[model samples]
Target: MTGTRTVVRHAPGKLFVAGEYAVVEPGTPAIVTAVGRTVTVTVRAADEPGVVIASDLVAQAMRWRWRGDRLEVCPGQDGPRVRRAAAHVVSAVETVARLLAEHGLPAPQLHVSVSSDLHEAGTKFGLGSSGAVTVAAVAAVAAHHGLELSLESRFRLALLATARIDPNGSGGDLAASTWGGWVAYRAPDRAFVLDLALRRGVGEALRAPWPGLAVRPLPPPRGLRLEVGWTGRPASTTSLVAGLHRRTWRGSASHQDFIKTSTDFVNAATDALETGDDGALLHQIRRAREELARLDAEERLGIFTPELTALCAAAEAVGGAAKPSGAGGGDCGIALLDAAAGHDIAHVRQRWAATGVQPLSVGPTPERNQE
Candidate 1:
């Protein structure tokens, strides 16, 4: 029999829309979208012993034996999270093994490698890295084990794995990582991946292409330009998110009100996006910052760190609005400026640098998916 290998790579980080910290609460809802970084999994046949797995970011290597009833993982020197993540992989394999055994089939001895382009893998940016990685890794495991699972099924399975690791996570991260592009979201609920038709024409738009498709035939627009800055202070997202959830569970009415306000801010931002109106987009971003400040006042919102607060104020001084984009409490802040007017992009860059913050440009658009 000829052995063929499959490699799956999923791109982009994501943002939480409605739920935020509340999604971790019992029955709270949230929405997220894959932005533009990636995790990739490659699978091929191995003549070696058992099943082998490796990851660059986690710096882990593991071996597992796949017996009919269970999958056992022999941990390498990776950290606690990596070791814990390994168990999730084994669980997925066991699930696959169970399915295959029912079909009177044998699971393959496979070798897999997982890698990611995470700027701050250890920090909590609230970009849903763990969820995305879980989804991508499990998809690889499913492929190597010869399991028949649909994309939706695979996404849900990944969410289950991530939830085991981080109970407060809404699973929106996994869904967004599985499906890219602009999204309309509600927490704990599924997000809608938008397929926008451009005013100029459908052929010329430049959003992330849907999976299993090719780039469009037409040329994309001039591109999306923004200044991305890092706050340089690392925060533990696990603890922060858990604490936020606990606050919500205690019926901290103030906290809930702040979340509601943030939701309104995002809803306004969504309208701006649909209209493709730059002025309105900036207006909504400003509104989001104001609402986030109210949330920050609660001390549980986790929006402001000294560096992040400085960065936000600085960006606004330059005619842009800035706020915590990801899980907050300090990872990074995004500054949306008027690219057309050349609105003090350099000033914002200098201000960020003064605080030892790094300026990463979210420059230009890439090609979109086509028929």
Candidate 2:
């Protein structure tokens, strides 16, 4: 943070390499990677004593003012769910304002500009757009207020902001966005922190111990060539996760089995990545796909759509392993192949085209540690 008139920050989108569904639970480990697509937020002093947000993605400008640590949008604005994109931004601003207040820095009137390439023609690419926006917004606002922040502090603020909207979320995507590389992530108790922020303010929440929160940088695969594919159909991660919460399968014996299987696969995959064992890594990737497939069939969660099934099948037919990335009724899927199989990678994309799946021209960011 500086006396510079404006502050701009960019955060990249993410893809879950393994442990998608299970990662929702606190303390569950997941492997995630930052992608090239990003959301950018720019903040500058405004002429008036209020906040104004203009987003090119939504193609609209909205005005707001902070009322007692809460963001109150233009009086008549209405949205039924807290999962809206606008809500994520609003929450991020409010959380950062709270942090600034703790340091005796006054929140300022600013105009925030957002530009995103995480979507197409108003449809999100499902590349963790929400998480990227929140991280970028948090950085921009904190810097605009001239508050210095650590990478972990910035991540905590973003998580607090996100949990206000979706308490059940794991914030794995947020971790990848902030860290900017392959990461091994574990989520803290979002519900606990949200309540703490509500009662004690965000400053206290940031300093308080978050028991299950852990993030570690992991090495990128040594021999696997990562490829991403989109199904063109968007999926609602919040609704799908909320739906899972309502099902009987959550606390059943099957639930324990899923957790164990996912844990084993994730641990093994992590080891393979660390050791650069391509054979062992491929086995774990396929194991993860099978576990997700089993969960879909048994719980009727609709984790895999026809297009997703075809996407995975096409990759396997070309001697690779693939699976749906996130909530996965539609979104995107990832494939991993031996880096030497250049021709097979092209063939997989061709087969994906034959089945209506679009190959995404995105790759993982280079290895990075906490900023």
Candidate 3:
């Protein structure tokens, strides 16, 4: 564990292109892309016996000790409120320990520092900052411990660690962070995976093939331009998803219809992307916005706020297709514009700013390095 070289890893934040709530259900697909904003983790040998973590996003330094198989946070931290933010890191450490043990290597004493470009002024832009951090940390720590993991292994580890942190997550963000670029993702069966993890442990769960889990890479649309605008307010994805679940929308005729339409849109969009069909892509985007609006109206879940609606309208006025990205009540809205209408992005940005939105400079990032 001594004299280990520092390992640095970067993982990009994610944005949803299409399909949201439906993706939580098994076999339902959602399109997500890893953006330029990233979380970086640096892992180096520690002088102390235990691990110390410094995070710029949380603005806190925390210590954790590995006692046998368990990772325990050191008592008496400055910010109690920020403790929850460490859950993902703790899970990563635990998982990495297991991975090292599985490879017959002892866990190392390390110091880890996490920094991010995904947030502005203490406010998250709903760009999957936590997922990126978790992915980067897991990758860096595992490499530091002399375990080289495949992309699939890294993804499974990240997903398992993230699921431990927030059980309600669908793991789309984790997939984006691991795979990068544009991907069509379907959530793994959480209930089944959690049960297996509880009984056989996370390592066993990672070794097993995840039934119904799908992650497919998609070609980026040619001549397609993306613009992201933040609402200057954060939205709780957990709360929004919980509200949808409380309604028991699953298996209902209306819910089924919505899913079918969304699936069709995704398929059409996929085809449009492959063919560089800007018109079809725009149509699909608008269709998705309409369907999401219908669901919001019927459920009264407030998925679309006034700001989101105004942002979409402004984007549409310039002949681009726009919608609220992710589980939106606020956060950011994304617009897809064609090359011919790219000049209108400035106008759209101005309109969004006038409505209290801040334009973000981000686009799809490359995949994680195989080495």
Candidate 4:
């Protein structure tokens, strides 16, 4: 790595298009995008091979090193399943180390710090906080070690690192946080990269241009609004993803049919955005959510808590259609509310407070949601 000090700030969490569960189905193309909350990673060289921590993730300082295919984790204690935690840390380090080597840079003696605005314990939002942190960490480490990687290459390495740990992992969250905003990633074989350009509007309005301008010929939509809520329950995304693959491989014909229909619905939803037809888009959104429910039922996914269900109903009753965000047992939900409903979005959020899940008021950022 080249620089002495490097800081990488990455936005947290993501929303999916189709294939929330199917992403683990190996070839399924999952659509994901970055949101407002973010985690920042700052890296500096240390004299030793130990890792110092200052994040809500773990209490004690963590240390580890690359040991071939295995990461040798030294957790400083046998305190209650420290082994497992160390394993995760080691896996992350190994993958990141390989990524740096792939770019022809040596790993530096690193001091890393991470901070996020998302819920601490519920970092279980199943939006891949671990992977996001790993991405930021890798970026910081690479910069410190003097390696320069293309943005696409960085995302690719992060995904590879994450997969080395959780093979059933969806590359969505890594892509979302690294690239930011809506991305329609086709299956890996097709190598299709569709830029929604959702960030341009916000960028122009703020008089700041987004980074990573590749000059893709895509036009931004006119106006848009999104209402996001929490389900108040966290999901074991790895398990859920594994289950999805198992079920899909079992050749449940009905599930196969459902996937096709859902893909079509999602495609229609995307088409609605291009037409500047919020009315049609809202309808498509509702249809997509309904299709997601059917798929979730088949996969036995989205087991919402009572509070989450109540919140969903409440949002629907208030001129919106609500759906769980990630692979859901509940981390959060998104409600694409119609602007004509005359319902104050703020007031709607207030109602959700009784359920312990606060509504997040989000707007496009200058970074990615460009026109």
Best candidate, TM-score = 2
Where does candidate 3 stray beyond 4 Å? 1-3, 201-203
Extract clashing residue pairs from model 3.
none
Q: What C-alpha lDDT, on a 0 to 100 scale, does residue 247 get in candidate 3?
A: 78
- TM-score (all chains, Cα) for each model: 0.75, 0.95, 0.94, 0.80
Query: What is candidate 2's TM-score against the reference?
Result: 0.95
Q: Against the true structure, whose lDDT is highest?
A: 2
Candidate 4 local Cα displacement, residue 145, angstroms: 1.4
lDDT of 3 by residue, 205-282 (tens): 878878779988888778878889888879998899877877778679999998899888988887887788888989
C-alpha lDDT score of every prediction, in listed order:
0.57, 0.86, 0.84, 0.57
Q: Rank the candidates by TM-score, best first.
A: 2, 3, 4, 1
The residue-by-residue lDDT of candidate 1 on 1-371, one tens digit each, is 22256646454566543335544443333334455666666777766757777767565577777665665665544466766656555554554444444456567576767666655565534455566667776666666555555555565556445554555555666666665554544333222111221132212211323222211111111222456677776666677766665654346677667556666665666665666765666776677666667666756556787778888888789677777766677776777776665648787888889987777643322322320
> Over the stretch 16-86, how does candidate 2's per-residue lDDT look in tens digits?
99999899889988999999888999999877777888887654677788777776776755453322557
**By the TM-score metric, which is better: model 1 or model 4?**
4
In the predicted model 2, the residue pairs found to clash are none
